[model samples]
Target: MKNILKTVIGIIIIVGIVAIFGLKNKESQDKKDISPNTSSSPSTLTVINNQIQVKNFEGSDFENITEKSIQVNQGSLVKTSSTGRGILESDNETTTIIDKNSEIRVAQSEQNKTKIELESGNLWSRVKKVFGQGEYYQIETNNAVATVRGTNFGTFFSDKQTIFMVSEGDVLAISINPETKKQIGPESTIGAGQKVIIKDGQDPIIEPLTESDKKLEWYVFNQTKTTPTATPRPSPTVSINPTPTEKPSPSPTSSPEPTPTPPEIISVIPKTINVTQGPVNFFVNGQKLKRVTGLFLNDILIKFFTIDEQTIGGTATSELQTGTYDVSVTLFTGEKLTLPEALVINNE
Candidate 1:
């Protein structure tokens, strides 16, 4: 009886040990699944010039970000001085530029999605293509949310309104209900060379981008970084002739001719059409396009053309071949701008 009792107690202790081990393992796994992503590298904020401030979620005092770059996590608030500018590169393949006198919060950041809240300021975001099904990049203000997959865009948020401008690709703009914190009303699509403004109690207003808008100081600064400037070749030196050969009279100094600004066509209405569709009116919108004297699909000219400062349109006849082609515009000065794969022709 004593031997049997000892065996029974030993078995009971073994069973109890196994049960405790299983329970502890399950609890650890549950904590791992529920906790935020702590293993991924944190996003960073880099100062371009001047100074910036960072306020941690647990800290009340704002600390100056003087290093070349500093890691930023969720709940961090970034603010720029009146002349300060900074760049934020997240692990999710998105980069954002914080403009001067602006503030933003890193709401939720992870390897797949990054959400930023623009409290009061201007920001430029460059997002890479997100291939995953649930992956997204978003910028939010109090009244609006701008979501994109892969594109370059700018957002300006103020008390009065929020402006979304797309330099490339597209952005979906949606208004938010203040009290319930849910999306409301119809969504607006803002395309390249276009902007949408969202005001309180009003629908989104879409408009073509203007030259002045493109010339904003921060916009131009970003452009210069992406667009490379050609290096000027050294002027050829002319060796003086031995003994002053007949010195010709100096020709009158004439002013150098001004360089022509290249006109562009960014958006084309009726981007797709079937061959069966007779003639269709197509509108082209862009900057510095007022001087465009001719518009072409492939090599053929559009008929009944009308040109304006920011827009041009004409009838696209059905005689054109059914294939994708470039849309190009020629300025009066002979400079040309071409948008590749802009018009698609289809067969019914």
Candidate 2:
């Protein structure tokens, strides 16, 4: 009886040791807390494939992408091949998932705001709660801009339409025409259970998301990817033509797509920051400063001022030193333009 009791005690000790090690392993696999992760760095690609290229602010080929974030900077573009899929997270409590054959452009990824342009493809965004006054996590396509105050949403953009759905929280979606450069339709405040479709030259369509739509592959936090077993491809048979006066042509050839023009910046208000303290408004005066997604002063990022609901330029990080700072603006179309020592300060 003594020998039997000794063996049982030994087994219990061994099992406890194994269990402790197993728990440690599980903790290692979990992602970090949102509070710290948001202030760390620009996104690192957790999963990636062979056909990824990182392009520079000038749209030049910056580097052939691996699972590395070294060559990626502001206004950098990530282009994926047909079989490519990748996920990236920023220090601002946001995760972006890009799926096969997509293009995602990092417009402005600062500590304050992160703006990504999903030019063409499938993107899943999971954003944490908004912290500051003027902070934003914006995902943009050609025809719509979806601002995620705090939510999980998926956007699928093809040549025909841009589809948006929110699985959690709220998303404010606005519709705009890429060709005509005009805001169309009423703004859509999408709740957790809603889905909306935005196409060019028309208002967005709102409806409740179906159960099958929930089965579509979207990235979930810390969960293993569920295999997408036969999600039916969304057909583009829905008509976009809202005009009834136009007669249909007998030919089946489709009209050519509109070539998008880049947004321009003409001037800057108070082109320098000289005050030692207080709010410094660095407003840019120009044609499409509303489409300006990023502002960098001497390569240091600052937040856009939203006071008085201004759509022009925003605020700077600090009061000015005695040196001239270079001004660079990144438009929503993934184009970056530099004005060359545009900001100057004089302390006499």
Give the top-scoring candidate (TM-score).
1
Candidate 2 lands at a TM-score of 0.50
* lDDT string, candidate 1, 1-348, tens digits: 999999999999999999999999997774454234564446777665456899865456889875656898776789999766677888776878889899998877777788888989899888866537887899999889999998889999888699998998899999887556587789999998999999876678899999999988656544412223454544544455567576555444454554554455666645775555555445565767766778888888875343335456555666877899898888889888888888787755
Clash list (residue pairs), candidate 1: none
Model 1 ranges off by over 4 Å: 1-41, 224-348
Q: How accurate is candidate 1 locally (lDDT)?
A: 0.75
* Total clashing pairs for each candidate: 0, 2
For model 2, state the Cα shift of residue 211 in Å. Answer: 2.3
lDDT of 2 at 52: 65
RMSD of 1: 22.4
- Taking all chains together, each candidate's TM-score versus the true structure is 0.54, 0.50
Please report the candidate that would top lDDT against the real structure. Answer: 1
Q: Write the per-residue lDDT of candidate 2 for residues 1-348, one digit (tens) a residue.
A: 999999999999999999999987675543121122334345565433345667765553556664323435565688877755566677776777677789988777778588888889888787765757888998888888888788878898998688888887898888888976477877889998789899887788888899878767442221122222343444445445578787664444454544444355445545555544433445453444556667777777776532111124445534545688777777778888776777775543
